[model samples]
Target: MTSQSESTEPSSALHDEQAPVKRVRVAAWAADPLTLNGLTQALMGRLDVFVAAGELPADVDVLVVAADRVTSEVMVSMRRAAAQCSAPMVLVTNELDRTRLLGAVECRVVAVLHRSAATEERLISTIDVVAGGGGLLPPNLLGDLLRQVQNLQEEVLTPRGLNTSGLTSREVDVIRLLAEGCDTEEIATRMCYSERTVKNVIYAMTSRFNLRNRPQLVAYAMRTGII
Candidate 1:
């Protein structure tokens, strides 16, 4: 057998280097320049080594936004960014309301950070995880969101003997029309059915689902996405 030295090639004078070809794409929407700059700087630095090593491609990976502005206008902008890029939105905000945060969640925001967060580690972890099709939220906010959903389920729904899962199409339509101020006559007219037919449909729906009344049916339809 050959000696170990004979089996190995001599070292080259120049090192063969590889650069990252793909990276986690991210879009950030924040309310302030300072916040935007801090976030961008942190992300860039943290991803630098991976970027340089060809693990990330320029087209497939990027920081799509570093906005120095935020408004209701930015909501549209953020949604457009999320849509066009097919990447998650990260909102860095000073105060995040549960109501608006739900809207953000609907638009596919997978990560959120406070403007005052001192480091990007959490944010970076969120980005990486979301890029890999996972989700993350701040502990307090996640709990609050869960509570909000639970409260809606328990208070507005459970007390009325309605669950979100048990609504049907005709029942949903009737309830939506009810919520829109349509009386029985108007609902029958709008649905192209006779008043008696509409009443019969509603009656059958209530009996089949064991719903108490129109109000309960309306609340159930809205909660369950049946309407």
Candidate 2:
């Protein structure tokens, strides 16, 4: 005969236990040895460390890249590192401007922390966001990012008849016609283009995106919100 209290105590203990949290896998890179050691030490225990001599671990969830200045040389190295690891990056820097901010995007960097303001808690929290497919940037960096997008759109993409989705105006018109079940000759007639020109447009889009057929291209347009 077991006492009711004994039975209840075990049940209470079971209820109190919690599942262990899964830690984010984090790797650190810096232009110099001292900064590298500092970042790795700061992130220890809070994250699962991934380190290798030659390459970043394929399973790393996030990478922290620290630099004194986000200059062209540092950005070049960061770009190479970003190529090696497809994981999102958190950049810690002493200085960053609009041009440098755009360069950071090229390196897959999702978060930017000013070196002066980045405490361990802040850095860890930023890494967690990047690991979760979210990002945080300071107000200044946010402004810079917006400016970069506007400039790129106004100066480059817009002039080329393209939008953020990388689809040109003509491409969008053709895709819209296709989605409306318009055949090539009908699309050409509606758009005042020759049938051969419409065919060339479709072929160009298919080749660019590697889509196999008209149906697939239409599906892609739908998926990408271009039509």
Candidate 3:
């Protein structure tokens, strides 16, 4: 004869299997009536639904801000709503400049997209990812971020005679000065190390990162924000 425990196991498992994943509520903040209408139609009659930001329902779990006329006030509004509902925000903008992107990140923006992405499947994917507490970025922005980091290394860090290269501080100094036309002799002199020590540092950086030449070494440093 089967025990009572065995009898309940199947019922519990069935309930667990049939339970619905929590549907995230989304609000659309679009200035364009057509785009907003299309988005409304897309999310209509869904379990997880969309609403206008101005008249968001009490159950909204996420706010999707239209990128038009985005300002400090809009960001403040998103933050307030997020704080109230413990929901994340997805910003839809035409373009994401460095300042806006940085500001969004600071304000806890979960995902950002171009207005043109309003109809793309990936936009929904990004919204889901953000709703689940993951960060999102444009596919091509990482390169620009790396380039900005490299510029910081060259223009700001290098002038102060600092090198943050070779995945370490001291080695970065060795490589940065080396890139700026310093020889082993000068590097050792400025860093107060023996010539052999400086050479060892350079050799280690090149070998570990698989860099081919001095220029390539510097390029790698810029690419990875090591310098």
- The model with the greatest TM-score is 2
TM-score to true structure, per model: 0.49, 0.78, 0.48
Candidates' C-alpha lDDT: 0.63, 0.88, 0.70
The top-ranked prediction according to lDDT is 2
Worst 10 residues of 1 by lDDT: 49-58
For model 1, the superposed segments whose C-alpha errors exceed 4 Å read 1-5, 8-21, 32-34, 48-71, 150-227
Better of 1 and 3 by lDDT: 3
User: lDDT per residue, candidate 3, 1-227, as tens digits?
Assistant: 88775763557667667666777687765556776776666655453666565655767766676746567676666666655554677777776667555456545676777777666576677777877778676766656655766876889777876554415578777778977999889999999999999888888878888888778888887777776
Superior candidate under TM-score, 2 versus 3: 2
Could you give candidate 1's per-residue lDDT for residues 1-227 as a string of tens digits?
A: 88876745545633555565666654443445665566667777655422211122334432333333344666776666555554455566666667666666666677666656725677677667766767767898898878877887788777765565544456567778888988899999999989998888788777776789888767766776766
Q: What lDDT score is found at residue 44 in candidate 2?
A: 88
Total clashes for model 3: 3
Q: Write the per-residue lDDT of candidate 2 for residues 135-183, one digit (tens) a residue.
A: 8888988888998899999999999989988888998999999999999
